[model samples]
Target: MKKLYSLFIALAGILCFTSCGDDYAYTAPEALDVTKADLYFKAPGGTGSIEVKTDRELQATSSVDWCSVSVSGGVVTAKVVKNESIESRAGTITLNDGVLTSLVAVYQEGFAFGIDASNLKTLNANAADSTSVIVTSSSPYIVNIPSYAASWLSYTADEDGKVTFHFTKNESGAPRGANVTISCDDREKSFTIRQYDINSFVGAWKVSYADGEDLYEEDITITSPSTGALYLNFAPLTPTVTPIFHCTYVNGGLKMANGNAQGRYSSYYLFTLFSSTDGYISWAATYTYSASPYIAEDGTFYMVFANDGSWPNKETNGVALGAFTSATATNAGFVGTLATYTDLVLYK
Candidate 1:
């Protein structure tokens, strides 16, 4: 027992001496080490912290007002601000622990207006009703479309908060395409649009031709609607008739089957030259097929409505004509047609 007691006493003394070997306070570390890949800030900015390892108190600060940093204990906290400008920005945060210093990169993404105008797709020439497209944007935006496209495209407003795409009929014989771009917060988004040919009957033309030994000149105009309704107009007609004439365009061609007749065309009053003495028969609705609309690479529209049949008065024939620039279409020179006349030719 005495030997055991002596051994215990010796062990206790040794343990006490080892426990009291050193009495030192916490000391500052030699380096500051941060462990984080990167910091991402949302719009305006946010607050976040990262894990750091160091024994001494640290100090932190930002290079720009967009970001700010502070240190508490072993961690570094940052306060990020959202970018109000359209452009994205970047900055840096520096941390120092007495003996060591470190750099951290802080990035902020650009502001988003959330503007989208990708709904519109295609257009038609003789459509009666206008087309529509919805626009979504939280911030202000600018619209950019080609001049030619803008001439026929617009915004259709029915009620508040009801956004629509409004447009006119494409009277050009050729098809065209355009791109609409929206600019927001210095960002850009583009959408594509297309227009189908509404044929050469979409413009005004000065009609000049020789009837027998006498020559007569007439003015004619054509219009296209958003509801696909195509019509033509003349100065004055006999029998007190309306100046507007309803017409049809189909499959890249024109059809005037009984244009001034009854039933389907009853709502409109046609027949521009209805005087039997005038000897210039108005366009008929029968067998007036084989007509097509075409456009040259120079943006000129032309039409071909020729038939190998004779009319009642047979005065002005060969309905082939080109789009009018100023007053007349000089491109159509000598169609060499006399469908309603004995010998007639169309010259520019």
Candidate 2:
């Protein structure tokens, strides 16, 4: 009976020792190593994921689901998920089982005008990105004066912020300078009076003829009607010899000259002033004459002569007769050379 009692005591002591050991024994959870942490997108909109790592094995049961995450008022709350492999993901994601959370900023594409031409006749705007913005005009707008494609009228913001626009008269017979309003992204701006004047119409012009085989060396001067009367002299060197006249504003058309002159009478003279946006003029003229004659109506003697002839043939002949003998005349034709002129001076 004593031995039995001793055995029970030993068993009880061993049980107490085992219970103490069990109370003291414990394994700490592994700490997650978040080597890299950042919000993928700095600008607004889109999801951001957090990455984390650990040296020891992680339990799936302790991991949190990512779909349950939520972000509000610019604050992001994510559920931690155990992903062993380092990789990118979408939506709100937490790293290392709730150790770290990253929130992506939400943003909408924005546009701005680096230069504002609202007060002027033209409007210019710069884009922040490759984004495109719809542009509308409040008052009637005319694009591409002189031409559409060659004119700088509209612009798309390519990655770089460079853009240009040109504005002018919209309706036919519109005022020289008219006001216009430009709008973009619900923003509106106004431009003052605009003009499509000869200043913008005039360009480097060359005169060519014979199907462009021959080109004349000359320049053209465009004088505004407001300044004074306008005239185009064919040969400025000899203004009187060959001059072309035109009205300052002749029914919006250029006045032209046409006439006939006698030969020798080198009607070589062709002075016609015409209008041309293409920078060209066509001038022409004609000449004619009658032949000398020898005739008699009352059977009186008469003679025909060419060149200069002298009657009463004396070295210093002076004669007086009761009647006359003959008389004559002739005809001829003449042509002139083409010439050109301009307002711009060119170096030889």
Candidate 3:
């Protein structure tokens, strides 16, 4: 009878345990949690992971095509693609478990493609004429000047940050240009070097004038010479030592007045005219050079002078006008052929 009573008690305990199933409860894992402290990626690109704890089923995605994302075994995985361009890029990685969400920034470095400025200068030929272009990256860089521009353009850098570029004056007739490049660090920058044309007629020369066989050979210093006009100073000083040649471009013709360039003094010659009946007469005469210094296409030059004013206009004063040229023509003598014996040539 006592054993039967014990069996009954054990059956009662089993029944109570079975009846408690209707009041049972369940618990979830946890809210979203991330293990990574940084969100950036490298250029070569690779797969990275984020340890996450969530209460419900979760999914992961990327805002940019450069980044891809997925989730497996309670962990969010992100894959960053390689950045092959010359520019840096950025994007975002997103995580959500239906309601709660999280975002992380993704970044990758590109090439070193920038400088402080886009334009480069020339006639930078001077120490005072240097251009400091700041480098935009930490990688090593190099400067390149074209072969044709080797004589003028160049580059110099003490270390990196700011580099100095130099250039020389252009001496060509037409405008000139070249390409200047900064290369290295997987990138480059291009700059154009443009320069103006050089002026002609800018030096000294010896000049020769003649009345007979071997006449006057003098050094004539030309100053401020240009296609427009020039100032001429004679070595063998004349009463009016300085003359101005007002030039015309069409045919390279020149004109000058009786006075000097500043018109301060007149170019006058004092002489005596011998007349058979009237005896000898003294006079001061002035001549104006017009269409004078005509430079021919073949490089030959010519000049002629006419009387501007005279004290006595007599037949003996026929030496008023004179003409000269660089041709092989012989001098016509001071008293023959209205054209006096004259020659003008470059002395040197």
Candidate 4:
């Protein structure tokens, strides 16, 4: 029995050693070359493959296995099992069974101009990485700011990365400066304003006889007599006035002089004046005229003077001559010819 036990023990030991040898754990193949290992995709439930080459032939019992593959945060990763084959195979073989990972980066495009409250345009953004758009103005506008206040305006950005701004005008109702601001990405850009002139106030004008019997009967174009000089010629049949006839602009109001005879002479003279607000002018004058009087459509002045010595003796009613039909002043002064009439000489 002891000898039989000994033999059994030996057999068991030998069998254990043989099984251990045959069941050796697989190790990743060394010196294996990755010739064409890259990302590849297949249909669902289909096997994906990664090709690799080896320096030697792999045993038939060995096999290659892919452990895992993944892509995240713009990066790709792959875990592969080295050669499972006992005998190495040369050239390239396909690797399958693990996920393949790859990475892609995110891109953005944006722009902005102007202010937060009265923004001209809001910020803009796009995913295409590049884009462009046009802006248009809706009105001819005037922005006013007090001289005492800070002239700079404010602006802000929109969600899409666009910005807008507004400008203030000066006391003269003109834009202060040409500078406009564009705010974007915590930065600013400036543009200039287009300026315009107030040249509409300078031009030419005329006067004609209106009222009973004289309605449109006498048409006169007071021609330019000299620099800042005007001439009025009466029709051959029209009545004449005294020798003194003066022409001047009062407070920007165009006026003509009317002279007095004998007891009728008063400190104030009637003036034929032109209105500044509207084109309508009338006859009015205080004995002592105001300086630089701002003329209005309702304001008046007259052409006061005696008609003749014979008519002067009688208690004659003063007449209100017609308003100024036209009056023109220029930087170079008045232009044209003076008219000639008896009894009335031109007054400065």
lDDT of each: 0.49, 0.27, 0.47, 0.27
**The best candidate in terms of TM-score:** 1
Candidate 3, residue 9: the lDDT equals 10
Candidate 4 lDDT over residue span 191-263, tens digit each: 4322211211112222233332333433333444544433344343223332222344332223344321211
Per-residue lDDT, model 1, residue 156, is 43
Worst 10 residues of 3 by lDDT: 1-10
* Deviation (Å) of 242 in candidate 2: 4.5
* Alpha-carbon runs more than 4 Å astray in model 2: 1-94, 98-118, 122-211, 219-348
User: What is the Å distance of residue 220 in model 2 from its true position?
Assistant: 6.7
**Candidate 1 per-residue lDDT over residues 246-279, each given as its tens digit:** 5577755554332242111123222222212333
Arranged by TM-score, best first:
1, 3, 2, 4
TM-score of each: 0.32, 0.25, 0.31, 0.19
Given candidate 4, what's the lDDT at residue 300? 22
TM-score of 4: 0.19
Each model's Cα RMSD = 18.6, 28.1, 22.9, 28.0
Please identify model 3 stretches exceeding 4 Å from their true place.
1-33, 41-59, 70-102, 107-120, 126-129, 134-144, 147-161, 166-178, 182-189, 194-348
lDDT of 1: 0.49
